[model samples]
Target: METVKEFAGMAAGTLFFILLTWALTSSYLEEYDLTSAKPATASVAAKVGTKSLLRPPAFFVKIRQDDGSPSEELHRISRSQMEKLSIGDPVSGYATGPTGFSTIRTIVYDSIFYMIGIFIFGFISLCCLFATILSIPAIDQAEQRSSHKRAVKKKRERRKKKKKPKRTRSGWGLALGCVAFFLLVTLPFLSNLVHSALPAGKNSAEALIINEDSYVTYRKHEDSSYRFNIVFDDEDGETILAIKDVTPNTYRNYSIGDSLPIEYQTSNPYNIHVRGTTLTDIQQMLLTWEMFLYAALFAVSGFVIWAYVNSRKNGRRDSRKGDRFASR
Candidate 1:
């Protein structure tokens, strides 16, 4: 009972460390939180010809669409400013109203995370090192009992060989399993990136919302999780959609009967994204967060497997050492 308790304690400790470390470094940003779609003003800055001679000369030029019409409002040009501004030009973007987020990469949040990661990583590494150190004496005892260990290992191999008759995966089964696992793990993010990399039909297809669901505000809880269904008349009959995620706009509101654009692939009519939309910084952050979480889960599962294997090895060694000392 004491030995069982000790074993459980060790397991709990290892799990605690692994989970705590992962939580610190994991990114959980939501893509819907990062979208901005308000009409913004764009004005090109007058190009300041090559500011510094030493540095790779950079220039900024202002751009503004001038309509001689009396009702035009002047706006600053930015990447998210929803204006036509050329790259490497003096284009600054500001939210016309109070809708744009930090627009600064959420550096403050990153700094807090940086500190948290450092603290957790340092703590867990230290704990692992301590465990390794404590095992040195046990390792010495194990070295003295190598022969009994060989006998036990042989018996384990016999058992495993016999047990293999119960479960078997053929070559094709293994290959298919691996393929399914990979697709399940990676397709969503790849598809999201594909929305940009793969060209949509140059000729826009007809799209209308069959079920917009309910209105969701994108800005609160700092998460932008919006779900809706869009149905469109496709080559394959009238196709209906339950859009898993549509990145939210600045308003953070998508209600019934609101028209959101969608672009579909010409070759594969099903591929689509909201029209006039690129992955916003927030959406990118959310995607990155997802990858981070998956990676953390993978790492933790790998570590647990490794630790299980190591513990089994250690137990065998300990049992051998006990038997050898008892013999002496």
Candidate 2:
């Protein structure tokens, strides 16, 4: 019984740490657009025609759109642009969108991510570390308790039956179990609520699919999903091509050479979301929440098992009592 408790605590702690980390990091990235641009050095290494593993330099530029909406796109500059540019210099480029050219824009290099990365990653790491420290003593106490309970149980079986203390609901174990059960049962609804509450992207664009790619996921067996290589023009008639994953249903619904609607937040264009799909920051949070919620359910399962063992012990005592009455 104690073994079960120890396993439950450790399992819950591990899952909580993992899920919390993912939720925090993902939210942080989406909120700040940390990965929209790459190092200027990476852009230099990238080739124009090939899919270079090197990242693009991060830059923020106000796109000269025909509508004059004062919108800006965050992205990395090309190799040639980086060579000609210096700090504080305005680099010119064409702003691209889904179907047609948006406008010409001037971009500048920015490298202030070191501090942001330190703060976000540091906070997540500390949370995991503290959780680990707390689990050690919990495991030990559970093990000791299990040993004593088993010993007492064996002694009771050999001796004559006595009236046991009435079971009560005031114990911490029962309370914790109830809380865990509540969380487990309501988890799906909570996730759905959070997803619905997340704000939709204000900016919309139409992207033309150039090609498609597929990958397998372990959800409900080997589920397949698709991604698209899309091409769209900016404000200056320059084409921007990128790959983005679509939902499984959406992937199957569309084919190569098809055009689909995409939307993104005003703060970060690269944080794109396909229309009518569940893919968003909230969805990522829900996935992480799911892992922790399942762990919570398992933690409570330990209590269920412990209760079953105690009930069996009580049943044995009652059987002995019936036998004595019958003999008399």
Candidate 3:
């Protein structure tokens, strides 16, 4: 019966940890625009209100003449040939019709869905946290029960009194400190909580990529990322510079002079994102710190249960030895 209880406690702890992790991940993905698997369906033109690239079943390309007019000449081009076009050279986008969701709509709807996800994940996390907290005392009680059984066994046999385990003042202080520290670190707020309170903004402009500044990093290996400076011109002829970071994958999707669909706050134009980019990069940094805290909690929960079970087994073994001595 004791073994069964121990097994159940361990199983519950494991399951709780797994659920907590999944909930956290789901909340993160939902908060950002990372849930889509389909490619962007927005039409790509060099500038808004300009003539769209001609669509044909067969691939074709157009070049700008020295006079800045579209050349009458057309070239049959393959995908590889398209890749070879020089910067400032005009080209056409994919011929397929629009299909993917708009970046602005996705961001607006994502914020609403993110709130719902946070509530669900937050509720589950709270329940599991309480269960974990209750398990600690239950484990301590199990140890006390094992100790009491051994003490009663000795009393029945007329043996010398055994000394009880003594916990020193420092031990009590250390235990209380650990409990306080655990609570402080595991309290979730840095990732999902911060995002939930962020001021919601709808991006209403299409940003034209004017320039790109690339840099190489050696964080994990040789890799590159880019910071793009884009210009957003409003209907009143006011132009704003919006800077965006592009990962290697996102950088491949665009080039200089390509117009990117984006959403930004009117109050803060610097806070902008390209349609293809998700806003997970910032949350990811916060997650790295919280990951260690949760990992420690999971390990401590399992360890406490294991220690309780081991203590019970040890007590039974000692009680059996007492019985053999009494018989002799």
Candidate 4:
């Protein structure tokens, strides 16, 4: 029964590793193909809009073939572009084989960053799969030998005085810390990095300013801070309720009903910036502090993973040595 259970566990682990490797490899290859493909011109056959309470709004342009028939390929576009596009409008983008079409403007930055991540993750998964397969037999043999020794020791232990085993530190603290760091620090910073790297024009539109207001925040020691808010709407007719923290000069320059160009993420409309003023510009203005912060985060995460793995190996070695000494 024990042998069967051990085999089952090993089989499950092997299967999981295989699936992980395949998934990562597939994602990396797909992104690579998309990045390398040449741009093609396709005419828009129809405009498609999708939105659900659970998912963000997405816009697509169905491609029309040379024969004036609609093809299965759909080119994703920004909401602002979708609103202005008409049937038979020429669209230039890369065809992702059967997946559909993608504009270079949309995937260029994403391909650079995401492809690197996918490649690294895929390589690690492949290594882990091979390691697991190679180590399973040896692990089983060691477990069997250890079990026999443990059985013999149990017999001797029954005849001797029972002694308390020393408790080892649990890994729960390290595990929790990693989890918290990933959630609070890693995810947010990575998201901001991606958003900041997004280029203007491709993911942005000119929004009409519908209203403007200003407020003062009274502080204890610091001088009162003034915040200017602007309300605008995109071409899609979706209203952006508030744009906060505009400079006093900027606030005074723009009036109600004026056009205020803004850039926004295609995935989330709420993530927006004024046309000339962006997160990227801010990072540059601050001497690329955001980039340094990202580097620091990456270094910290790598160190933590290395430390955890090393500590586990050391703990196992120490435990094995203690067991051997106890047996004698």
Candidate 5:
């Protein structure tokens, strides 16, 4: 049983620490929401609004005309366009046939989801914090019971005309000090909680290239997975390309610079088109931080349980040894 005075003091002190920590963390959360993986604020510089380069299904060459000839005009002639368009063909309007999601919608939806997640995580933090705080009283109670038992032993020793005992548990000062120490240990862990998301876009000035290099890559390298940079526009700008084997012997490739097939965003640009396939999944920094934090939490919890069990065992062992020596 805890003295009312001690219990009230401890309870008040613990709540104070929790509120202080929550305030500091909330401020930092706001900052994180502003800067990192923000869909609304983050955007690619260029956009692939209405135009996409059509790669030829077959080799297509231009018809040559010398003077005022309709056939001799300079035009981008892909194999698909050749059946309908002749030389000097002036194609009008956006390429509509590509099927995919819109960047603007994805960005908006992602931002909303992010806001929801932050709110939910804040609640979870409170729950974990409550668990930590509640553990304090149980820790205090265990110490107190051990102290009371030691007192009984001392009284019995005095009856036997033995020397007075020095001390066992430190005192109430130690108990109060432990509340502070718990704060010192667990407060910093709040930093590990995190959330992040990325958006890629086409006008995003990224590179997509397929040539002899890719052909040689598949032929030379065996089936070990790899992450490497590939040249986008003119080999000067390099964006990350993910190469994965979706099928048994076929490689799926992705350039990080482009958005999904269709759609536009007013605020964000870096939104990339994502498919059901895991071909383009890339790890973000926030996720790694969260992983480390959770790992640390587990480690500390294990240590706490270990310390409690070890302390009880040692207390019992010392009591038995003291009794043996007194008998002698």
Candidate 6:
């Protein structure tokens, strides 16, 4: 009766996992199809205007008709597309909708991130399914052992052994060590992987250097350290403010009211990058491949360690059984 209950619980858990995986997969497929659709080319003549001042700021285009009259409808745009436009610059791209209300799809709005979600859920579901299947044999073996009185006595004897406690502690220690190692090695790569997937600064624009300052920190028996910072704002009257750390030479080179060439991330205007600092397409591809390689190595190393530890434990158990039989 207990075994039946255990099986039922496992079935329920496996079904839940499978359902979650299916939902995520379906959503991902739908998004993939939307993004894969061929975009239409259309001439867009509109004046750019800010729609919202929120984070990940939104913009809209006041469409101008061919007869020089403004259309009633406004088309929304992303930050990357908006950055290149002044209050009234012509916007043109592969449009995603009808002529007067077309939107240009940019990297910020892509569905690539859904791939990561689907992959994670699918992996979890597969692991749950395999675990449930493997546990059936273990449950049967446990039931058979429980039916024998001598097996119960032997189990009690094994539990009382001091070596069993030490072995368990060692196993737990190894597991913790492996987990720590895996996180230490993979966390940086994972961070880079996610960052690479997101939209970065693509267009360069000059920001007015509003202020510059230097601070000094003195240490005992050491020369005072100087930190230079500059504050800048973009030209769109959008009030994009960013403070950047600069070297002594760079700080001295630019003064207040100077135009500083800079690039800011589309998703976050405050996260500024120096001009020409963004990764190229090939470099981004290499970074993704490197992350995958590190993940594969960690998985292989963990499997090898687990297999070695299990073999050692099995050998010890077999030697103990042989000693008991010889004595009898």
Q: Pick by lDDT: which candidate is best?
A: 4
TM-score per candidate: 0.31, 0.30, 0.28, 0.33, 0.21, 0.31
At residue 306, candidate 5 shows an lDDT of: 70
Question: What is the C-alpha lDDT profile of model 2 across 1-328, one tens digit per residue?
Answer: 7656765676676666566667666765454453443322111111112121111122233333346443334335454453354433444333232322211222222323434554665675676566555456665677577677877888878653542333333454576567676776656545434433467534667878888888776675333446776666534444445566555567777888898786543443443456665455335433443445555665676666677578668888999999999999
Looking at candidate 5, what is the lDDT of residue 140? 60
Model 1, C-alpha of 167: deviation from truth (Å): 28
What does the lDDT read for residue 116 in candidate 5?
Answer: 58
Pairwise lDDT winner, candidates 3 and 6: 6
Q: Name the runs in model 1 displaced over 4 angstroms.
A: 1-184, 200-203, 213-224, 235-237, 250-254, 278-288, 291-328
RMSD, every candidate, angstroms: 20.6, 16.7, 20.6, 15.4, 21.0, 15.2
Where does candidate 5 stray beyond 4 Å? 1-287
lDDT of 5 by residue, 121-180 (tens): 666557655655555777767867767787788888776543322232454236435545
The regions of model 2 sitting more than 4 angstroms off are 1-201, 217-223, 233-240, 278-328
- On residues 257-290, what C-alpha lDDT tens digit does candidate 4 reach at each position? 8776666666556455556654644543333333
Flag the better candidate by lDDT, 5 or 6: 6
On the 0 to 100 scale, the lDDT of residue 234 in model 4 is: 52
For TM-score, the strongest prediction is: 4
Cα lDDT, all candidates: 0.47, 0.51, 0.51, 0.59, 0.38, 0.56
Residue-level lDDT for 149 in candidate 4: 82
Give the winner by lDDT: 1 or 2. 2
Worst 10 residues of 2 by lDDT: 47-56
Question: What shift in Å separates residue 221 of candidate 3 from its native position after superposition?
Answer: 6.2
Whole-model lDDT, model 5:
0.38
